[model samples]
Target: MVLRAVAVSRTQEDGGRSELLRGTGVGPVGGLAASGLVLGMQCALLGVGAGTGLLALEGARPADALAYGAAVCGTCALLAAATMLLAQLTTDATGARGAGLAALGLLYAGHGVWAAERWSRAGAWSPFALRGAIDPGGADDWCPLLVAGAALLVLLAVAAAAARGRDLGVGLIRFGLRHRRPLRAGGPVTLALRLSRMQLLAWAVATAAVAGVLTAMGENMVELARRGAVEGGVLGSLLGGSDPGAGLLDYIGVLAGALACAQAVVLVGRFAAEERSELVEAERGTGSGSARLLSAWCLVSLLAAALTLGAAALVSGLVGAALLDTTAGDALRLVAGQWPSAAASAGVTALLGGLWPQARWLAWAPLLGRVA
Candidate 1:
């Protein structure tokens, strides 16, 4: 009887280990390495594409192109590493998912700052020129001071939102309910929604704030142009023929929105995978159905994209109008024009989440392909 019991116990232990492995998608080290390699290749291709395109547009030399490509690849690798580290640390799928979003938000903010710096420097107006027109010596001191102040303000606002979000364990803006009443029983869909909602909102707010700042800055370009600070007529034409600042802001906001939307799609795709794993199934077996579960996931994902983009657009429009002294109508028109492309990008991401179960990372393939 003792020997028979021992054999039965061994069988149960082996079965339990198998189930755990399947649930987490954790396999042997070889399998993990293989999966990582595949992801790296896809990301590298994207980096190459983006690098080459940027080089072509900027008319960079071969050396610059190589440098840019290397940088892109390195950045992608860093992002991947950060993501995996977050997954390991949280040991919770939802936390891993939120880390992906928070990383994207940081990326967007970084890009916005970079762009703003480049635009401000390359922009037509310098303190020297302003000094030449008015008081020469005074211009130098004030110009840098003004730009630095504005940049600092924007950065601080974004940082504050991020900090607040971390505290609340939600997105920058609160969404849905702050707290849920303890229920006698809840299912998978409810649980998924609860886990994801806060993270989604935090990401949206961070992305939107960056977009808004960039857009507002762009609206000031027309004033710069009117002052004849910008010599290049061609450049002015490209910048929307409005105030140089406003034009640049508009362009940056649109680009930022597109990028943020891509991040949102990638995020949602990952969420879907987490949902399919045994963790969600266990919750579902308790009460959840496919429709309810999927719907909640979809809603949270869509909300993240919409709120991020919408905040960006609205902020850009408001700031641009304020700076340019334009009517609300004009501002709305500019914002509206950029929406179609952004919406399409978001839709493509949603489709990928729903359609592809295995190789779900392929949803990012298109964005990666564009980089190549």
Candidate 2:
């Protein structure tokens, strides 16, 4: 939903490409406030909808549902604010959204790892730990929620102050600033790689981190399965259908592959960004064909997907072999299957971007749906 900021940035004259907000008689801070209000309202509506569902499902008191709703609202508003800040730190809206979603993925994965390892007490400071802190089943703790709200406010204040001092449509942190030359024309594929190198590297690191954590988590899950089996609990069968350790490891491996494919989708958005910025037309004017540009981008996304997913699977398999006595074949096969899926995602996004740049954001719909 915060992608709206980027989408709107193109239409508003004072917000377009490089125009200052004050050109519309609104200071940058005021502009932030205005957009922030819109994002907050959206978040609030989402919270109300989500809270209503929670109320229906859990039969919780209205007060508890309202509390959960506030948590959801505040967290979402914070994410939108952070995404706005990211847009100021990236060369384009796509990079900002990609990085923002990646950050959210990392936070969710960290919480997952914490939960999988059963680190209930010591991992209280983990990102999104408020889920447990706000749980009605977990003592109805509210202190952490208040602390998180305070931290979010402070961060928003800092972001607004920083935005006041920055130029429009320029990142505070950028890549290759010292290099002044335009991309060499002979190698469009090379240019694509250069453009997306940083984002790919960031995703690679994040994938590896999650792969390692999930791989390690398999052993803990196996242990819990054994405990549940002894206690005759249903969670044992649910967690580990038959072969506890190996099954959980394979599940984690496939999950890592999915993450890798999602990373590839992030690279696809760079193509969309290029189209939005008219970089595609500029390349065309320099004799680069549209088909070639898009094919090159698709190829880059595929290669990145392969490398990151392959590495993640290898890492997971190696760790599982050592820790959980699992074989590598299943992990390798699972990732092999995802190669085509990643390619498809890349092709879909690249084609949409080439044909209708406005709808390029729709590429994320399927992935978000799956995650949901």
Maximum-lDDT candidate? 2
RMSD score of candidate 2 (Å): 3.7
Q: What is the TM-score of each candidate against the true structure?
A: 0.56, 0.83
On the 0 to 100 scale, the lDDT of residue 110 in model 2 is: 70
User: Candidate 2 on 318-339: residue-level lDDT in tens?
Assistant: 8878887667885676544567
> How high a TM-score does candidate 1 get?
0.56
lDDT of 2: 0.68
Off by over 4 Å in 1: 1-62, 81-94, 100-104, 107-190, 216-222, 226-238, 241-253, 263-271, 283-288, 324-356, 359-372
Residue 259 of model 1, lDDT score = 55
Residue 111, candidate 1: Cα error in Å is: 6.1
Best by TM-score: 2
- Which ranges of candidate 2 are over 4 A from the true structure? 1-21, 86-102, 109-123, 174-176, 179-182, 226-238, 354-356
Provide the lDDT at 209 for model 1.
Answer: 68
lDDT per model vs. reference: 0.50, 0.68
